[model samples]
Target: MSEHSYIAGIPLVLGGNVFGWTAKGDGAFAVLDAFYEAGGRMIDTADVYSAWVPGHEGGESEAVIGEWMESRSVRNDMRIHTKTGMLGGAELYEPARVLHSLDASLERLRSDTIDLYYAHKDYPELEIGQIVEAFDGAVQSGKVIALGASNFDAARLGAALDAANATGATPFTALQNEYNLVNREAYGPDLQALAQSRGIAMLPFFGLASGYLTGKYRTEEDFAKSMRGGRAQQLAGGKGPQVLEVMDAVATETGASLSAIALAWLVRQPGIPAPIASARTVDQLNELLEFTQVELSDDQLARLTAAA
Candidate 1:
């Protein structure tokens, strides 16, 4: 793929899952502006974002992004990546549902075309050829510039690619999965190899392990710092602290923040063009932007990998 085909030059993709949820209204706007001003390009969101929240029917994040893009007049400069599927009562990957979901997402994003559209999860019950045909239909209609898959394993992704190739459909150009310094079981070597061989860009979410790698959740008291405290506590009980220690050393040596080191490690991995991260505040966004300035050494990378 060409550098401009996927999210190139930018080593980070700002996540929109926090928008209209933890970060509301002007807070979301400020964070978006800060990110763009810092040279960030892609913004990842979904149709079901914040739907679990009490009065939300989803599309909250996409609406915020749409408004921000219009008000800032940066719609042309931004690469909007949104997803379908995985919404409550609409998890199937059938053609009619896929097209309906894409139209709704387009309306919410205020864009005639989505730069990259993703299937949020794999529905094993659905036929791979049918799913490919549905997504390819969006591409042919100019509603989507590119296609992607998230939360899909190696076998399923391979099958989808095969189906697309055989049926003359547009194959998924990107893969988004849960991969971080501490959580590597889901996206292991096999998946990485398949994505690399197929030229699919890997943009892993939860790149900072839900803020655990930021070094703020060191102790029990630290867990109170955010709403993800319970998860942080659970991670701290495992190899989370060990990963933090190695990251600390790398940070001390490289003069980069823990978040930057964590993200830098991700961007350096095989087949990974960028990593997805979110900041509820402008300060946090600035910290994440620092990853571009950080370049880990071979020894440092090895030590960090071994530690993890």
Candidate 2:
């Protein structure tokens, strides 16, 4: 069985990638305040978050989150999830490396224990037993409550589970895949089935397709709205416009914004506990938090599923 109960009611995981990158300091704090005020419980970040930015060496986002927690005095109220792979100059998925990376995460988050820790990317060549043992060591140290795997395929996830079972470590309780209206194939069939069979909670990243599903970017002009515009063009490719049309219809039918409806669909999926989405401002957060209260109907869901 899973070891974490971090996300139960909230329909979304407030993505922490924007902290210290797009929403630094007070701006990030405001977004966090908005999220908790609206009943959000889980905040997802990583040790390597925003490390791709110039002059950043990673852990910047986690530091901001720790500061927010200290400032707000609600550390116990929210579940903190952070990843350990692909940060700084570290290699991926080595057992000894996992120890060092998580220690760094602990210091940055200023927490004795993380509610959930994920291997940011799966390393296929590594022995599953070794990986599972590494995570179990964290749990043994009382530094992590549960461990998760992101960016892994069905076969690898199955192997990880077997290793965890053999080593008697905390099994993976959650999954973070690139799942959204535009990006479906990555986590479509095999991963979905495996997660369901193992009862692992699904937490999809790129939940809004990098803000494409928000209905704000429909043309070349809209691309200028974000520095991530070039990446957003993938959504504007084949059938992108058609998907937007369906989303628009659903928005009209449900009286929900396109972003909310999109997230509601993920929440309504079989294994998904919450969809991970980031907001750079309180205004954006308000729109995302609304998904906690919004429910999409069967027809609306069908429309989206088919269109997507």
List where candidate 1 sits over 4 angstroms from the true fold: 1-4, 89-91, 235-237
Tens-place lDDT per residue, model 2, 1-308, is 12357774466788999999999978889999988888888899998888889999999999999989988898899889999878533354555677788888888888888998998887666777767777777778778887888888888888889878876778887888888887787687888888888988889998988888888888888898778776777755686788899998877777889888889888877688788999999999988877766788888888889985
Q: Model 1 misses residue 139 by how many Å?
A: 1.4
Clashes of 2: 0
How badly does each model clash, as a count of residue pairs? Answer: 0, 0
TM-score of 2: 0.95
- How do the residues 122-180 of candidate 1 rate in per-residue lDDT, one tens digit apiece? 87777777778888988988788999999989999999999998988999989999988
lDDT values, one for every candidate:
0.87, 0.83
State in Å the error of residue 99, model 2. Answer: 1.6
lDDT leader: 1
Q: TM-scores of the models, in the given order?
A: 0.96, 0.95
